[model samples]
Target: MTPTDTRALVAIDLGAESCRVSLLRWLPTGPQCTLVHRFLNNAVETENGLRWKIDAIEAGLMEGLHRCAAIATEGVRSIAVDGWAVDYARLDDDGKAMEDPYCYRDVRNITSEESVHAIIPAAQMRVLTAIGIMRINTLYQLYADKLAGRPQAPWLNLPEYILERLGGRRVSEYTNATHTQLIDMHTGTWATGIFERLELDPEMAAPLVLPGSIVGKVTGELATLPAFADTQLVAPCCHDTASAIAGIPDAADDWAYISSGTWSLVGTLLQEAINTQPAREENLTNFGGAGGRILFHKNVNGMWLLRGCLDVWRAAGKDWSFDELLPLAEAQHTPHHLLDVDDPDLLLPGDMPNRINRQLLERGFGEISTKPEDAPAMTALILHSLAARYAQVLGAIADITGKKLKKLYIVGGGSRNALLNRLTAQATGLEVVVGASESSTLGNFAVQMAAVESSADAETIAEWAGVLRTAF
Candidate 1:
């Protein structure tokens, strides 16, 4: 396949709150992208703990693929999947999941994080991995499984697991693998020293592959469809944040990005890793980006806070949508008390309103009422807190990277939040450029297009990204 081929392409974005399947078709005029399907995705509490229903997620994706097959008479040429990182599925000997993957938010990771730090201090871990030492990271999650004495088995992160399920070989895309915090910062391979120190089996990890590498041709029932007959499964920045960043058309070095969704990743792209003592001290991460760049950033708590609060309100009969709440939140005066948006207690689910109020009370500020009517106040507080946090992180990024950021590109679901965008611009004092709400989808398709056209090198990705942004 090449640039001249007119076959349509498919990009599957598996998000924390929702999953979408997008289709890209090339026509004489230009490229056209259509959102063929989107479905709600949530972790459910079970006898064990919070776990994703991989079966349901797989079904939803398949349904979308069928829709794409039905609509794209040009025939789908290739497919790729990008998603939130960290959480993974343990696989049995036959490559089948042992059970649903544990949600990164599962409380078990708290103990696991403590245990890992006990053996290999957090500072050392950060210097070794050059990744943010967060409890939700794959290292802690896997350590949790080990502490529970769960059977040892090979594992794959969510997006790559989806690709393997679609008949791709078991391999971790480099961008997603770095999020595990088990990869050597310098070597770009599994950190054997960390594995030895933690007593983990290094072989359990899949071999690392660069983005745009074709894993396999589509197989299984879906492959039987005419549109999928020759579809290749390409790994395109399997970490959704990486793909979202790739979707940006601007090639300027004076811009940072916030892949705003369930979590907001605030950072700028760099030519190399920054694993110095100062970088480790700030808890900033250096994730792998498309074209082998470093995604120097900090993970700030994002929409999850508002979503958790909304969940509590909905159960209490408030059921306010963002559309109904944002205006009210904007109409209200700035919150007198700002939250430490990355508060540990706010990371978990359940009773968000109380958790927020508890933080307020602890800080000696008056608590916001949980009444349905006062939800906007809470919403405003969350947005304000997030914006303030973003500004702080961006400041740190500038100081560490020496990049004078002039623009902040907001992408993902939160890009649609005008209120948050305005607040971020005001707080960060940078010109805010609102990118696509489905930027991950655009990046996914862009990579697929690049892979098929020639190669997914830096120049190729940028060219395709520009083309897609224009068409979008």
Candidate 2:
């Protein structure tokens, strides 16, 4: 423990498919992190659409925090949270959430998105915000809400929504806010003009805060947790991708960040948005980032293809594990065909392999196999295709931004896949550093440390980040 006894922070990270709560503590043994709890998270589809079950997730985190409180002799100094971007909740005037927010994978926005393109034109939005042309963006999601008739819900982005209900403050973090596509590229604030265009109530949107800001503290029954009542709640690059990028140890100019998870977020950090014509054509995004940087990245269809294939295979009784599939595919040699992971059809959930096969057939690749042996080969091909796509997208990001990124850092769950990693290194032709798979947790702790110190600036945060490079 530290000389004063309080030697750590808590960071809670939520994802589309899972959630984790960990305690980062320092001791004579040096720094260590204990994962107090983790749970699977899947959007529960409702009459409205696919949405997160926040109550269940919060319950899991509470149980985890309680466990951490039991283990630590002294209370942690602070806590922070980060989660998947683009999904959020509506709050009532009293600050209670109206309902669980829609999942980014929901389909209703498909219709409204075309209208979004018509308003600003997809090309124009790309030039203005450097965001990709996706129907599931916050802009399209909010537009879908206005069409549904319930207009004036309280403004709370996902992490803020959860933190607020736990007695923490209600506000949006800029890194996550940029994912909303409603934030101005240059000003780094909500684009009032875009909201006006969508007829969205500006009041319903929360104010944008930055990473390392202390919003509030957990309250209500949660406040009763031993050693946690006095802990401050910090906003730490609240978007999982943003946090993952922040976790990268290097501060050099020519580095790229590949926050590999369910999705492969391949991009680099920039001082400002790359809102250029070529960037627009490439559908490259300039999302708000940690340390006041921009995350210029693209979402590549990632391990989802393989996972989805396994899911279907398991239902059919094959029950193959990823470990098993890796070797099987590695040994087999088969002629390959590829499908664009970003195809609109693949965006919505269902039989992913079937969708992939169907798309391949439409593109004249012919039908694929249902045999177990084929799963591995197909999965490898999928990974290779993803690597190729990453290279393609990064090339454009480099062209549009005029930045020469020579190194790539891969983090999150998918980074554990060595096969994909080697292929990515080969495809990008850059020196690759395998980062701690739990980058969000590191980033969460980083921001908490910075928030506790009022004088901490971007440079200071970057310096302290060396602590993370060692923690792993």
Candidate 3:
């Protein structure tokens, strides 16, 4: 596994709205990438609550792997999985998933959020973990399970659980683990003090491993697939944002990144975590980034607003592709109601248009129409609101981290939105550079390659990322 190694690597990026399986096939000329498979991924509403379709996701992944094996006639070197953070799966003693992992958007966390905060206030928790106290964080979900008298067993983030299921060792990757609000930012381990105060068994947490650790070789029935045979299972930035940041092709500290998709993570990378009172009050989170960097950012509600609205529109027989809808939004020049995208009411499922209007009315603003013809206005509103929020968060990060921002890197599916990129640049007054649309997947593959090359150190990861990302 040297730079000259020609073996292919597979990267599975599990996203909130969709999941993708991509392959980097090394060739004599250069590495070539193929999107082996992609499938729509959505949390289904169940009798218990809204939950991820974990079984369906697993099946889809296997199908994708078989396809990759067929294409990569060259032997596959390794594989890795990166995904959204916080929501996790609880496993029993026998390594059985007790139930489907709850979607972070599920309403069940509302009650538990209060109880958990009563024990350890959000501000104080921020001081401990240096992570924003989101209601959907894994800590609140685990607290809910504890209150319901559920058995205490090993609980792993969704990606970690999937890796374990695939014969990789069960361990929490550091980047994703930081999102749980249970890890101490200073020590990079479970906050024993917080867990004790909340009566949680800290042992339930899997051992913390940094990104690029080789979990193990692929195992179980899936290993029988040609692509998985002898394939090492590696952990990239298990949190998609971390992976996306790692996939940045350039190296510089003056630029910020917005891992824009269902959620917009706006921040810059720092070597040290920020836990100042101002940072806590602003709800900024300091996540572990690749290359010994700290992801200092805010989690702003993103495309979920427009995505929910689009669902309502399509159900009403007003169907249009996202491409077609964007131009319509860009063409509409009328001033519209602005929304505080982070409002909790807008965080749930169903009738998003109405919820937005209600918020607008409460704010003494005119209500926008939900009709299909009004899609342009709605889309514009959502995009503008998001850009504004990004700017606000960027300003806060700059103030707190004392980093003078020079450029903004917009990555992920949302990077394709030309209008949003322009608006982001205008709102933040920083040049917005957009590319690496599949950054998380690229980072996933880069990390695997680093592990294979046995140069998985942070500096090597950053260097290898630039070379690997060329496949895109």
- Top lDDT hit: 1
Rank list by lDDT? 1, 3, 2
Global fold similarity of model 1 (TM-score): 0.98
Model 2 Cα shift for residue 416 (angstroms)? 0.4
Per-residue accuracy of model 3 over 33-102 as CA lDDT, tens digit each: 8998999999999998899988889888888888988888777888899999998888987686888888
- Against the true structure, what is every candidate's RMSD? 1.3, 1.9, 1.5
Span of 10 residues, lowest total lDDT, candidate 3 = 1-10
Q: Give the whole-model CA lDDT for all candidates, comma-separated.
A: 0.91, 0.78, 0.87
TM-score, per-candidate, Cα-based:
0.98, 0.95, 0.97
Write model 2 residue lDDT over 168-235, tens digit each, in one string: 76788888888888888777777888888768878778887888888887677756767776777888
lDDT of 2 at 137: 81
- Kindly list the per-residue Cα lDDT of model 1 for residues 113-172, writing each as its tens digit: 999999999988987888988999999998998999987799999999999999999999
- Is candidate 1 or 2 superior in TM-score? 1
The list of candidate 2 runs beyond 4 A from truth reads 1-5, 454-456
List runs of model 1 lying over 4 Å from the truth: none
Identify the candidate with maximal TM-score: 1
